[model samples]
Target: MHSSPRSRRIDEHTIRSLPKAEVHVHLEGTFSLLDILTLAKDNGVRLPGPAATLFDITTHDAFTAPAVTSGGGAGAGAAGLSGFLRFLDWQCGLVRTPAQAARVAYAFAARQSASGVRYSDVIVNPTHWNAWHGRELALMDALASGFDEAEQDGLCAVSIAYSLLRSQSAADAEAVVTDLITRRPHRVVALSVDGDEKVTGRTGEKFRAAFARAAQGGLHRTVHAGESSGPEGVWDAVELLQAERIDHGVRAVEDPALLDRLVGGGISLGVCPRSNVTLGISPSWHEHPLRRLHEAGVLVTLNTDDPAPLGTTLEADWAVAAEQFGFDHADLVGFAARSIDASFADPDTKASLHTELASVAASAVDATTTA
Candidate 1:
């Protein structure tokens, strides 16, 4: 039965009220356009266009807009994943100082709190931050300091995942792991690798030693695969990199054997449906493989991959699962529970969040019965 407007509103309310955890989100992509405008002015970086008209040009339109190229004019650089990535590099370049980094981190935490995300594993790619090149450790410290303040102020608790670029050399990857092990920057919980897999194909063998070192040093592993490439990349992530979680593993649905492997190995997939649609990975929401993957019993959780540029929020993503994918209240609650389990949070935090989720789930059940 089609849900009434009132029922949809209730569902949205319930999703927003749920204490949630997000496992895949990029800190660099969290900045609002206004945030970018402010940062640009602060740093004296000229935008590709005027601020007032920039919004119309930079916003993404899946059908009409061409893929954004590096150094392209305003609208051209905000359309596809590659273009969105260039925008990330440009906006991140504006944060020249540690204080600016802190400001953005605190703002991210605050936004998460507003959206009912109690905890998030935020990915930080040093390659995006042009100003912080060769000073990644200092950048990490600045981000951690900001998150620490946010946590102390009772905002969402955040953990960092230091990501390696796909194009980086094996030595560069090893150095990142070594730095993480030696310094042990606060709130950094995992090691991840993300870049355009289409541009640099099959790099798992290249970063294997570095990921192994990360494992030996007690860091959790997550890899981006199956988005730009096919199931082969997902296989490398599991077999070669030993990733506990796969980001954008939607393409695994194409290979039943890979689906079996993911399910058997208990690997979690951080599937961002709208992002897939926006980037032309999947043709539309209904065609997206999130439903197929979830039905196959793979541990799947919804996320907003790059919220700001993509124009998404965690709550809105959950709503898509409900309204588009036909996940009911119980299923949504289950996904939320699985997200906490898949997180790199402490056991105590996971347990506590589960308890809180249980309370909200019960209330949701009651409200549904009444409605």
Candidate 2:
């Protein structure tokens, strides 16, 4: 063991795989190639592929045929796109029933366990399930069952959130919050506003309503802002939505005053750098806003918004931030702590996890020093 801070970090693996607490993974976005294929088959929904040629649901281009999806046959999606949107549509369809929701949740939880995620706040759109079951209560029941089952399997625990669509009208968005809160407040820990980042802002009244309901229901509020639009969107998400944390809030770096507000307000940022880069909202890893925000005393945490679609995971996402943002070990380790600090878990859980993280870091340092 080197017994020196400089030597410890340098000799360490370039990619640090510490125990992670993932707060931003969407259920729809967590579908593995096998999971999606299984769901598609079970739902009688035909996807574009054989097992080897599959794309995740959150794709930018249109669906390419199975052969074209893997770049085998004459690429159908060379310019325009075909069976891709079907997969996207079918992802929701597969979870229409309660049993299916439990299965997906369990599978997602199992995947997280393998990634060393000790705790996860998995985001799911109840509106998608609600629309199918004809009521919000049914969707909540299904999610509750899924979370309960995941708990039993040592995936630790899961807290659920209902995501409001940006494309929805103001009244419609309010209905989602109102219905979910009314039906199952305990099971639902947060309310998220997502979809187009362009849609995250400009809907001030809708945010206002959602925030009011979130506060009243004792649920935290968050929004997907700043990645697609400007820092102004971050402002709206924090102010209008009463966001405890802003998702993908890299654009806040462009506005110093907004950055000050974020620091002063004690709001956390749920940043997903790879997702931003892959979605074309960001230029590259080195350009991410996380390092500047962290240095400025703002509360920022790392996350993987869609892991598999971008062919990465929480570890890879953290490594990208570390490598490009010039973050050393403390910064990377702090990234994990920040997520734990911003979590919806109880004080006891937070305290215990914090100690666990510190212990893990200490062990790594000790091993290096003694070796």
Q: Which candidate wins on lDDT?
A: 1
**In candidate 1, which residue pairs clash?**
none
Q: What TM-score, to 2 decimals, does candidate 2 have?
A: 0.85
Can you give the TM-score per candidate against the true fold? Answer: 0.91, 0.85
How far does residue 5 in candidate 2 sit from its true spot (Å)?
A: 18
* lDDT by candidate, in order shown: 0.83, 0.67
Clashing pairs for predicted structure model 2, backbone only: 1-368, 1-369, 1-370, 1-371, 2-368, 2-369, 3-369, 63-84
Write model 1 residue lDDT over 1-371, tens digit each, in one string. Answer: 23421124224667878888998888976888778888998988888665664534345332233342221111122244454566667778899999999989999999898888899999898888889999998999999999999999999999999998888899999999999999998888999998878778999999999999999999999999998899999999999999999988999999999999999999999988877887778888877888788889999988888787666788887887677766777878888899998899999999999999999999878987999
Instruction: Give, for candidate 2, the lowest lDDT window spanning 10 residues.
Output: 67-76
Clashes of each: 0, 8
